[model samples]
Target chain A: MSSFVERRLSSPVKVAWLVALTWVGCVYALGLVHQPDVAGDASGGFWALVIALWVVATLSVAGLAGLKLRSKPGRLAVDLLTPFLFGAFLFFLWEVIVVGFGVPPALMPPPSAIWERILVSTDLLWADFRQTFLKGVLAGYAIGCLSGFAVAILADRVPFLRRGLLPVGNFVAALPIIGIAPIMVMWFGFDWQSKAAVVVVMTFFPMLVNVVAGLEEASRMERDLMRSYAAGYWETLIKLRLPAALPFVFNALKINSTLALIGAIVAEFFGTPIVGMGFRISAEAARLGLDMVWAVIAMAAVAGSAFYGLVALVERAATFWHPSIRK
Target chain B: MSTTSIPLVGAARPGLLGKLWRGNVGPVLVVVAAIMVVWYVAAVAMNWQGVSERFARMGQDASAGAVFWQTMAEDRPMLPVPHQILVELHKTVLDVAPTSRRSLVYHATETISATLVGFLMGSALGVLLAVGIVHLRTLQKSLMPWVISSQTVPILAIAPIIVVVLGSIGLRGLIPKAIISAYLCFFPVTIGMVKGLEAPDRMQRDLMRTYSASTAEIFWKLRLPASLPYLFASLKVAIAISLVGAIVAELPTGAQAGLGARLLAGSYYGQTIQIWSALVVAAACAALLVVAVGLLEKAVMKAMGGRP
Candidate 1:
């Protein structure tokens, strides 16, 4: 029996099966606590039993994650399953603790309530998505990035300007740029335009700094080669330097994707139309409608992630030849 | 990087002027001067309409030059001239008593206190989390993905929620703002520290093992020291964002003490100059915090026998 147990420990498949069984046990224990009669008033002994089961399940998952699976598919499966199980367990704990203890929805709504709120408020969420993400974030991101790119090229040709601008750009990037949101609101009026303007300022400097750094990425040998071919500045830029700068440019893009969302949302807090996510959040929060506030936050999270993921996907496609992406 | 070393082609002579030209001071000054000029011009142009309207209401046919002069001195200009903002800063920051609610110093202190508290807590938590993740395979596998994805979420969007919820629970004032600041900053620290803690190579670890150096000794002597540079780099970033987080947190509270509150009050009253002054103070706070971290990094690095 000891030899059989040692063999089971050494085999990845067996360890995974053991982990699965422990998780099942945890779920069953959770079910016991989640019952209508037991919830919010479970006995101390019962709580201890459920918690002990959870601890075992967590340890089992960890053990499974720690196993050295040699096969590529097996490794990939474990890689994917570990985080999934961890996240699922977290949600499970959140649900059980909040519901079982009868925590007030005002203070902390369970995930189930948040999900239900999302399901019921699709129209409001979509409108906010359109207002903030589609209008403010996209428009401002495009303008800011393009202008920064143009100015970076101009600065590259003028060595003095580059020297003057790089430090300033870095300084501006570090500032609490969202402070300008109120000024933008005053200038553009309380609408998406102000939010877009704030995003434009917030995004421009990072893009400029990155593009300037990117422009310098082409090595001396590469530039000399272009010179030997009599390739003009624009030609070298388009064919060689710009391509080399793809990674840095994408870095700026990825950073700005998040910044743009943040700028737009925060700008709305200064003032915005009633339809935007920030407005909903600040308004609902003030009125103590935390579920709705969380619902909006959930929407913002999904939107922000989707925006960042989209940029990253584009980056991968554009800079496939870059070492980082190739790896 | 090459751009910093580039001397002015025509001004490469041996003199104070040439030395200044070669260094960043001259160029940065020139750039700042240019910005001021542009700002003044934009200020005049933007405030032109309002000034003209005022003149028209007074039934005075003011000349273009007169109108231009008036633009620079409007009570609530569309864009306050640099001098006007400077004057406002002078009044609010230096003229008023530091303890007064009306003083920029008081507001800055309020914001900075929250920022520093949050930064300290967040960075400590982050380093601890990083140490755990590096030492525990289970943690590295289970938590790293969530850490990265958490950043993708615009965590700042939930600042108001956190502030309000925490307030409802009677955890008000600086604590809630600090919590928001902590949330904003911890991500960078965690990412940086994780990379830092894992920086020691296999050879280094093997050497430690050969010496019979325990895990604690390896961490304290090798891992911690190596992680210092990365820690400081992220600390610089973390401090700046922590200030931002604190400022944003102050917004929802509408509490009249912090820089963010000043900004909100200014916007509500159409006090353009007040807003500009508050923004400048906030910017100064961010700059000082970041520079402080940088100086601390340099000192620590030097003491550790590393070349700063």
Candidate 2:
């Protein structure tokens, strides 16, 4: 055991491990008494066993972290893994405490309950995925981005509009979506269309602002060259302004991708025909189906993250020239 | 593409209204006036139920006098005429009892409290998290991605969960709403402050290092001061976002005293007049908060040696 410890950990790490082990032993000796409700479960002994393993895991973390700190070349591993370990630790503690104490699902469901629900509710999950991800978010995002891009172009072409519109755009951009979402619901009624309308409003101004800033990129020399070449407005735009604006436009697109999902989801919560991720999450929570609620939330998170990640990848590809994406 | 154009004006001297309305004031007023005029006309002509509907079909146009009369008509559903809304506002703010639910001031105070509490908590936590992340590379990676991603989780979805869970545990009232508000507001502050704190070029950092400045000194004396502009800008945004969060939190859980609950109650009962009045109050609340931020920003900037 000592050799194994030496191979894996530095002196400081070994000391920390020894300390943690001693604490774990003390905790074990102090007792494995459970709550009156949970002390009778078949898995009480199993849980106490898991609790002991948690100690071992905690010690391993301290040992690894210390080893990483003392090394000259391995700090990068520590740097990346520490937060991951912390997050995992948080999840572990949550699971253990919630289960060990036999907390009610209605109040706070265990992670295992959430996982099990996710495994079972494939159909309801699919329906929500279709309503939110496929129809509402995608449609709203496309229309919002395109409209913002077109308006930005017009704003750019007309000097008066650029001066006149950008500040107003800024004001409009600051308008909160909650203020607008219900209004959209009132206007469009309770359907995916209303939800899509909310998404559009949420996304439009941000994209417009980004695209406008982006078009300001070309240098004086570049514009002068274009002028000397006698390029038309569209010619100059297609060749130069639009390309320069790609990074900013992509920035807006990435932002709006998430915004669109959020808008659609939130819109559904206000009033819907009993479908969509937001609706399901709301309805399930109301019913005290905590596991199902988590299942829907997990689905929404995955969908939202995937959408954002895809936009980011596209941005990386398109803006390879941008200083922000260094080699 | 042209780097420079002839300046909008030859010199800095403003021509009266140009000075008062110069930065953003004129444009905001102009837009408000235009919106009001359109709303008044649509109220009469379309007989719209409320502003929301009028806004949906708002692109249609009419003459000024005709629009004016149409707005005054009792039949309008979508557009409440300017005069009518003013009367309603008068009743809510000036005429109604101070403690009445119908009074905008009382409701506004309640909403404001939630907004303030949430914004402070959010801004404070955001700053703390930013400081930690900047000092520790371990935090910057795993947490940064999660922080950004956390935002994508619709507050609507999470609010219900929070309210339900917290309510079950006998925790309700201002704190729950404030927690949600803080969640929304903190993201911008964190992201912005991180950028701001790391704003200095390598040369400037090296200069600081040359003086043998400690991390705390370097942060307090150099980085913190440098990050003020970014911090304030984000604060302005965060405050507005927090108000929205507070209001939304009200919606999911139907608090008795919030602007959100008023809107929800009005909508449920189909009280168009009440709904419009509450909306006006909310919009005014936002406007006031923004104006306050602008004032604070100007003061800070002025104190910071008046634009170099």
- Give the winner by lDDT: 1
True contacts kept of 1: 0.72
Cα DockQ of the candidate 1 complex: 0.63
lDDT of 2: 0.75
- Tens digits of per-residue lDDT for model 1 on A1-327? 223343446667667677777678767857787788887877787778767767766665676567777799988988888788888888878877887788888888888889999999899889998999899999999999989989999888877788889999999999999999999999999989998899999889999999999998999889888889988888998999999998989899999989999999989988888889888888888888888888988888888899889999999899888888798
What is every candidate's C-alpha DockQ against the true complex, given to 2 decimals?
A: 0.63, 0.34
Please report the candidate that would top TM-score against the real structure.
Answer: 1
Residue B70 of model 2: what lDDT?
49
lDDT string, candidate 2, A71-145, tens digits: 656577655554566566566566666766667879887776799888888998999899888988888888888
In candidate 1, residue B256 scores what lDDT?
70
Off by over 4 Å in 1: A1-10, A26-34, B1-12
